[model samples]
Target: MGNYRFILSGGGTGGHIYPAIAIANELKRRYPDAEFLFVGAKDKMEMEKVPNAGYEIEGLWISGLQRKLTWKNMMFPLKLISSLIKAGKIVRRFKPDVAIGTGGFASGPLLQRATKKGVPCLLQEQNSYAGITNKLLADKAKRICVAYDNMEKFFPKEKIVKTGNPVRADLVNLICSKEEALTFFGLDPAKKTVLILGGSLGARRINQLVESKLDFFATHDVQLLWQCGKLYLTDYEKYDSNTVKVKAFLNRMDYAYTAADFIISRAGAGSVSELCLVGKPVVFIPSPNVAEDHQTKNAEALVARDAALMIKEKELDSEFEAKFSGLMKSVQDQERLGGNMKKMALPKATEQIVDEIEKLLK
Candidate 1:
């Protein structure tokens, strides 16, 4: 077997970070002796998460270019220069066989340096619309793994590989019984269950909508396994009822997926992949505060194929309650969405991506 060493760079949100971790796991499964080096923004979530996943990481002093021109923009040039130097140092020392960029600020410097050193570099962009960082790295990226098509608008059409996003393996075949799942969460299996998720860090808009509508849930006999995000507990806790349980995170995500009949979530790429694998009816509230409004675009891609439903963030106040109520009552609609979504799921993408990496190493 060829010596397999990799540098994985990505961070910011779970959308970018989790896919990087999933790819690393696939690499480990394919080549037991493979060594990995993770690169992330110094103060970002990746610093904590990468170590938790059992990988060593180097941090770069990098941050996104601010949307609004604040004092933060003044520090941008200095950070960029320092990060580039740090990236070069890491690449030289590690001498990776391949460098993978999943999508975040840290990826820009690391992938650029790796490509400059003649290492094979791959970039996996999760959104339908390309972000500024990924767009900048596209020219240097030898192959671009993507979840959406028509990306010719962003990257070279020939370099794009539609591998879909990698998801948790347990979610693919969640064969756990409903009774076991409900018991794990201490919920009533006899009642309808709704799972509320707003990405890993949580979306403020979604948490607000769920809190406003909590009292209405009892009317339909739906119990909520509400994941309000650690950031929004103050607002969400005020609405807690016997029928609704609030949590910052769900450790046993398998139980949450297996127990819920319906889900309300942000349309992140990682979440989209997991929802499809779970095969549950979902209502996507795409967070507009995100870059390029890509979440809405991601939801539309599925909605066009009858695989999901989407509601815009601005319209949530006027529409979410009525729309959610109607969907809850329509068993036929739920079944249609679930079936089409499951049909669209790419359960083998994890294996397929690993296979590609193996071929490269061999």
Candidate 2:
């Protein structure tokens, strides 16, 4: 095999960025001599995150169009034109063997340019509902790798592949023991740990719910290992004590997953996939603010299988405490839910996606 060159374009959120990173890491493992280039939107998190993950990345001048007509929305066409030109230049210079897109606005221009240059492109859609960009690019994609089934509703049936979403390597098979994980987080071994995740930017409703329920959690003799995200960390930090450990982010997710007896998380596709692999009983509080309300649909998929529990944002105030209390009181229910969730995990997702890329390379 020759030294292959690969281009990955995705970003705007961790859901998109992390999957692209995972795929790159797997591809690198298979072809150590291979060169990788990442393209993401300028001023987005991927510019910093992809570099931190040890890769070179180029930024395109692009942003998603806002729903309301505003100054940013007015500039959308100009940005798209600029990004397409820049993306075309990058593709011409890079001459990649294959281009992989993990579903983001940046990937739209880059993959479109790559396809125009006769480069094979693979699109990975993490959500049950396909992204607008992926749907638009589906016609030219050599393959559409997805986490959810029924993607034929969005992409060409012949091109769709259910390879699942790629999660962080550390989360796949947690080597850290529960004891070790507890120590890593400085969490109490005596109390049952309830790990709370509100996404990287934090969810305001989730934060408010957690804050209101602190006393209830204390009463149940459960300790909180909360990742409230950076935006709300300052506001939530004052409540941190022996029972509640609040963090802006959980850099060591392996430890966080291992230490928890149960989890409360937002229902982002990346989070759902990671939680399934972790095999813990989880309560999903999906953000209603997301495009297409896809988060709710993601959670519902798990709930329908009896693999996890979900409380919609609108129902959280009325249903959360009762649902949580019921879950807390039933040890049998926890084990059953955890076992079922594990059965749904596609642990080898990254490897499978790379396998498709390898085929394209040949």
Candidate 3:
């Protein structure tokens, strides 16, 4: 293994941070002696997570611009200037062979400075619709790794590489049986299991839907394994019982996937990739709060291929019961969705992304 130095930057949410960690882990596996440095926004999740993953990280005084006029929006220019200066110093001091970005506010300045220094850079765009950070850096990126097809509209066609998004390596192959998973979660094996996920921080609407529909699940003989996320755990944990298991986060996602017969999830790109590998019937309620309504676009890509079903948040109040009831009752629909999702699984995404990184190193 070559003892090369590398820099990675991404943050704000688990969708961005986890992919960066996954790529770092893959590179570590291949080059045990290589040095890795992570750059992320100072107050974001990545500051804590990167260190937990066993890598040293530096934080930039940066944040995304607010959509409305606010104090934070006013500070964007100053923050960008400060981050750019710090990123340049970090790049010069680290002297990384290659810099990689998984989309986030911090990556914009980090990659921009790296490119100016004549360093090779690669960008991993997780969403079907590219984020502003990735779009702005596309011209200078030596290779653009992507999870979805036809990313030519976002990045240069020649540089685009459909390597897919990196997900947790442990989740790529699950060996837990349904019965074991049911026992682990203390649910009845006879009942259909539905896993609810609204990303790591949780979704308010999803939590409210589950709250109102607790009886709906019980009457239908379906067990609920709800990940309420950290944001709303206190508000919803009181409803947890034998039939419904509510948690702030799921540490053993492999076991959760094994227990689930069906899934209700937000359509973040990383979640979509993991769900595809898990091969379960999924109903995506793409969070309407994301950039460019990208979560909806991500879910649509699968829905178009008949790999999954989608229920927009706006229509959920009127249409959720009918759509959800139909899905739960039909074994044929469940099998078809699961089969199609499995076909779209890219289990080797982490390896493939590392392969692209290696190419740039060469």
Candidate 4:
């Protein structure tokens, strides 16, 4: 039991990669002698992130097919074939007790090969709408763990498990106090502070929206702690001031969540899950450019339940100000939204997913 080996594959975005890491971490804690390896697309973010998380990873020459005709689409067949062969070799070499996929391009080939080799495979789908990768591998997956309900529409009903999405450990148990969080970021606690997140790479339109509203925030006696992402720091850093703190990235999300009176963010599945645990009033601006438009679907699920508010990317110009201003003006709305959102928190998601993985080993 203690010497179990596991292989995990997920990548491209933090949504997929973080869940895989969270699951691996739980497995490591449960089985200290467990060997773990990760497979990811060669040039994707997972290549760097997995190693930084203290796991060995193999990279495959794989990427998703583009909808429109492109050079990458032309290369898909060759890459998929190359990845399948490499994945098969890895599955044979590692001899893992369980294979886990968190739904990404690399996971497509890796988990497919693992299942074909008779390795028990588990898939985690983060969105309300199932990803194409997960759906394609569903028939062979021993279990399909998901964050949203009605996922049976995508996966075999027998294999579907509503385990929710795994969130980072720090976010699950916030240790910082509001005063300390404000002090750490050098912000005044007297003014209402809104934390703006555009994801790890940043959102261009979200950044633009924030820039246009800086004067509006100031007029309302509010301050801003904006995590504009590393990619957009050069473009948006000029707006940094006493009333506005523009950071390239936030290393201390616990502190950021603690200090915020409100939050504005992109509605990536990972962000949505973390926000549920954080339980703050959030305005989700989902990116329209995702697979199946899942980000909007993620936000809408919460919005439908009165757990959060959503403004689509296209409607941001027309709706953001009115929606945001109205929310800001109401304390009861904040409390209600925050309370309902907390009710949706699945803090034990990682542990539960690991429970499924553990069962596979038996």
Candidate 5:
């Protein structure tokens, strides 16, 4: 393996950051002598996470434009200019063999500058619906790695590669037993378990629904393993008990997947990919307040294939009980959903994406 220098840029959320990290980790494993530099937006989670993963990272003075009018919007031009200039300097100094972007604010400037400097660039678009930054970079990128099909509508058809989103390596081949997972969580092996996930910041509607329906779960002899997220931990921690296990975060997701007979989650691209691999029946409540309502689109794609179920946020209050109760009552539906989801799992996604990078380097 060559002692190649590589630059990776992505952040703003775990969906983008984790995929970038996964790709970088795979590259590092294969090319142990390689040097890596991660560029992320200042104050974003990646600024903290990348370093902890044993890679050096630089922060750019950049952020996304707010949808609604705000003081921050006024400084967008200045920030963009500053970020571009700094990105150019970084590219010139590092002289990377290749630059990869996983779609985030910082990636826009970094990949743009690197591409201009004649560095081979690749993009990994996790969403079915491409983000503005990735779409803009599509033409310049040597390859566009994506999880979804029919992305030719968004990118140059010739450059698109259907490499699914990179998921956690451990989850690709989960080996934990249900009984052991139940013991780890102090859960009952006999009772059906439903795991709820709302990302690291929590989903307000999901938390509210869980809180209101706690008794319903008990009445039906079902148990809850809810990851309510850090932001809402204090607000929902009071409800944690023997039947209901509410946590801010779950470190051992493999065990959680083993214990869960069903799952309710937000449909971020990364979460969707992981769920498909876990093969648990899931009901996605995609947050409506995202770019292009992309979460809804992601969930709809699975729903179209009968691989999963989804309920929109606005329809939650009127539709939650019926949907939840219907799924709970039918064991056949659970099996069908889980089976279909597993069929969609792309276990080799990480490997295929790195393969594309290696081709570019060669």
Candidate 6:
């Protein structure tokens, strides 16, 4: 156990990448002398993000099967073969004691190879519904750590551990006090602030809703920190008024969360976990564009519990204003939403995950 060696594989999207890194960071903190390696899809976001996170990474030539029947399907077999060969080589060379998979095509071949090497492989599943890669690796996974409960439906009951997903360290650590957060974002300390996030890539539908409702926000004296993602429809300054601040990405999410009185966002699992930590009154506008329509399912799981509110991506353009405005008008209702959400927070997910990894090694 003192000679700890670990491998982590996940990513294609930030949802998978960030959690994988969060788990890795925790493990590193626990075992500072441990050797760590990341296996990720070639040319994907993880290729860049993993390196930026200060870890060594090996890339596998893997991508998800295209949803539609297309020429891309023809390349799947070749990519599968190439990825397996690459994955096997990486596993054999690193000789990891334990392997962790978050979710993504890259994780499939890598974890499969690790299992073949008789390494202890643990799978961390972030969604309420299991992902395709996690499903494929289920039989090989020695332990399964999941964010949602009742996942015996997805994995062997014996392997399931109801450990929550690892959220970003910076997020769980409040970076700014309320007054500092208010001034940093240029929001009025006296006025309630609304934060709008649409993932790191941004959601077109959510961005459009905010664009149309700028004047409506001013009417309420509500300040906004709108994360428009990269698909900024128009110059942010063009849409800028006294009440709205629009940016492609919000690097200082902690401050945004601190200043926000209410929030609107797509219900990607990572964001959901972070919100549970922040516990702000939120209106989740789940993106219908995701694989398996999982975002909607994630939002519904919370909305059904009366912990949060949800709107459809299709309905966001139509219903967001009416619903959000109604919620914002009621201070008591807002407090209730915030309090219920806070009750759901698994602030120790990172610590719990690290403990599990330590137990596995022991």
User: Which tens-of-lDDT digit does each residue in 1-362 have in candidate 3?
Assistant: 47999999999988899999999998998998999999999999999999999999999999998899999999999999999999999999999999999999999999999999999999999999999999999999999999898889998999998888898878888988878888888989888899999888899999999999888888889989999999999999998898999999998898899999889999999999999998889999999998899999999999999999999988988988898899988999999999999999988988998898999895
* TM match of model 4 to true structure: 0.98
Listing every candidate in turn, what is its Cα RMSD in Å to the true structure after a full C-alpha superposition? 1.5, 1.2, 1.1, 1.0, 0.9, 1.4
Per model, how many backbone clashes are there?
0, 0, 0, 0, 0, 0
TM-score for candidate 2, residues paired by index: 0.97
lDDT of each: 0.88, 0.93, 0.93, 0.93, 0.94, 0.86
- Alpha carbon lDDT at 203, candidate 2: 86
Residue 16 displacement in candidate 4 (angstroms): 1.0
TM-score: which is higher, 1 or 4? Answer: 4
Q: Which candidate, 3 or 5, has the higher lDDT? A: 5
lDDT of 4 by residue, 142-169 (tens): 9989988888889999998888899888
lDDT of 6 by residue, 1-362 (tens): 45589999999999899888998888888778889999999889999998999999988888889989988789999999999999999999888989999999999999998899899889999998899999989998888988887789889999888778788788877867999987887777888888999888778777778878888888888888888887773645477555778778888888889989889988989999999999889999888877888888888888876779998866666677788888988888888888888888888987887777777784
- Candidate 3: which stretches are off by over 4 Å? none
Q: Tell me how far the alpha carbon of residue 340 in candidate 3 is from the true structure, in angstroms, after superposition.
A: 0.8
- What is the TM-score of each predicted model, taking all chains together? 0.96, 0.97, 0.98, 0.98, 0.98, 0.96
Segments of candidate 5 deviating more than 4 angstroms: none
Q: How displaced is residue 83 in candidate 2, in Å?
A: 1.3
Question: How many clashes does the backbone of model 4 have?
Answer: 0
lDDT of 5 by residue, 215-303 (tens): 88888899999999999999999988888999999999999998999999999999999999999899999999999899999999999
lDDT of 1 at 169: 80
Cα distance off (Å), candidate 6, residue 38: 0.5
> Which is better, 1 or 2, measured by lDDT?
2
Residue-level lDDT tens digits of model 1 in 1-362: 63489899999988889889999998887778888999999999999999999999999999998889988899999999999999999999999999999999999999999999998888888888888889999998888888877888999998888888888888878989999999888898789999999876777888878777867888788999999888888867776666788888898888899999999999989888888888889999998888888899999999998999898988888888788888888999999999998887888876776666655552
In candidate 6, which residue ranges exceed 4 Å CA deviation? none
